[model samples]
Target: MQNQTETYMRRALELAKRGAGHVSPNPMVGCVIVKDGRIIGEGWHEYCGGLHAERNALKNCTEDPAGADLYVTLEPCCHWGRTPPCTDAILEKRIGRVFVGCLDANPLVAGKGAQILRDAGIPVETGICEDECRRLNEVFFHYITNKTPYVVLKYAMTLDGKIAAYTGDSRWVTGEAARRHVHETRAQLSGIMVGVGTVLTDDPLLTCRIEGGRNPYRIICDSHARTPLDCQLIRTAHEIDTVIAVTEWNERAAALKKAGAHLVLCQAKNDKVDLTDLMHQLGAHGLDSILLEGGAELAFAALEAGIVHKVQAYIAPKLIGGAAAKTPLGGTGFAKMADAMPLKNVTVTPLGEDFLIEGVL
Candidate 1:
């Protein structure tokens, strides 16, 4: 028989998915209330500054739940921020037991919630499906530890490993399914980033078009402030957030600023934008997860800086080989094969005619 802890934790994980694209700088959490082996209530963190998972679940539980067990994907928050402390709610409800999938890494709540429950004479069991729970809030974990947004580098390439043709024509490399999948990905992250080369060549709007997906903030790494003022991103900046990362001030800075782009100035090395500085700035702005779609140079820089936590590559079956074709990564690549990046816990899924390869580095 499946462990009851696992069953309830899995349900909580599913519930947490509803909060994607809405919770930023805060971990996604889900709660399930079970009484006499039957679920009585469920809830998830919906958005920033909104009611948390525990409170939401308690609100939905209309029955007498004094002896019910609560299953939570993440540790219940013990300190107050946007709302009341979840620990206090659990105490008042007289919950009989608690199952925690993972401990909260935030300094304010780290293991304190579980301690409070135990001190209140309530039984608390932790580490149920711990790895899965941590993976779900990987960006929040990274931010709490490193003070930077978790970076994910994603791109679509051909069988020959080229991102663009020699002539820079890359409208549709992957199938429609893969493209739709990319839109879903964009909707889940806090921001989408690309280099100036991609912005100039592709003129992408970088908005989420999926039915239920939310558009993330768009970011451009343009060292010289060269983003065209008339581009789609510039034109739509007033409606959505757009950030322009530049290494030096240029003549077009005032014009781009007037176009509603927030300019972030960072130092340049070898006449290139410093990826590390950009990441720090992004973290300070409360972006806990960032998706990097690139024109090669940016991907290589992120990889070189050791900041890319995950990589998603969509590979089409067709072959397009040319000496000048742009590859997915560009920079001073490693000199030896042993120095190449290694991926673990890899997953390969077929998306229509293309294959989606994803893993952690």
Candidate 2:
């Protein structure tokens, strides 16, 4: 039974992966229903504002789901939102047994969803294939439980560990395929954050220029009010909403606001702004996930604070041997190798000229 449960849970994870770019604001969920020790039906959440995993599985089952065993990759959502509460739906279906991979970390649904099922007399088992399940929704879980954004440290560096030429003229490091892949990633996240260094150096618009999907929030971490008002990211309001994080008493706060920027004032630490606090502020504003596009220092801070949950890197097939040229994160690497907390489970795959790495805390 344990092996069967593992197999089914893995399938559910694969289902969740299928809808990666399409589901936002809604965590991708996968579910399976088994009866008499046999798989009966399976389904995954298709998109935002759509039916959840439990409902999708129930609809797929031809038999009466009453007394059947239901297995889900994530905790059944109990809150009332775009769709009905999944816990109630499971009760109505008369599922007698429930196996969950991980608890939903959203403060509103965390333990309450599981409790609701127990109250209805459904036998519940949790933590089966737990690590894999969390890996599937790492971004969502990290934001909800940690009160910080999930950081994906994306960088294109040479095999010798240099991100750009000595002159810092890294106009395009990775192939076109990889660059396009980055755009797809931008479309999936709720927000894409970078430091002022990236804004001043790259002057990136930071919008999704891929074939489909809406643009994500453009966030800039400007500690000393260095980002210029005329930067492409700030000027392109129609393409994406932009947010600037500044020190609590920054004099440029009003100027940034006058330039039509949403400014978040946060406490400073070590003469730099605290990214974790800024992330919490974004969460309060309803941001569920964020992608950290690098300037190095911000990425290092996110990792140092134990806030980065995943990393995606595009390795270009060249070798620029300058030690001063930045690596993935900007400043001195992680304080110590021990300071880097190990992800419970990690999965890596090749995506054209890049590599896709997903991990969980």
User: How do the predictions measure up, each by TM-score?
Assistant: 0.97, 0.82
* Tens-place lDDT digits, model 1, residues 220-243: 999999999999999999998999
Tell me the spans in candidate 1 whose CA falls farther than 4 Å from its real position: none
RMSD after Cα superposition, model 1: 1.4
Q: In angstroms, how far off is 5's CA in candidate 1?
A: 1.6
Alpha carbon lDDT of each predicted model: 0.91, 0.80
Runs of candidate 2 with Cα error greater than 4 angstroms are 18-26, 34-41, 47-49, 79-82, 106-121, 248-255, 304-306, 332-348, 353-361
Clashing pairs in 2: 296-329, 296-330
Best by lDDT: 1
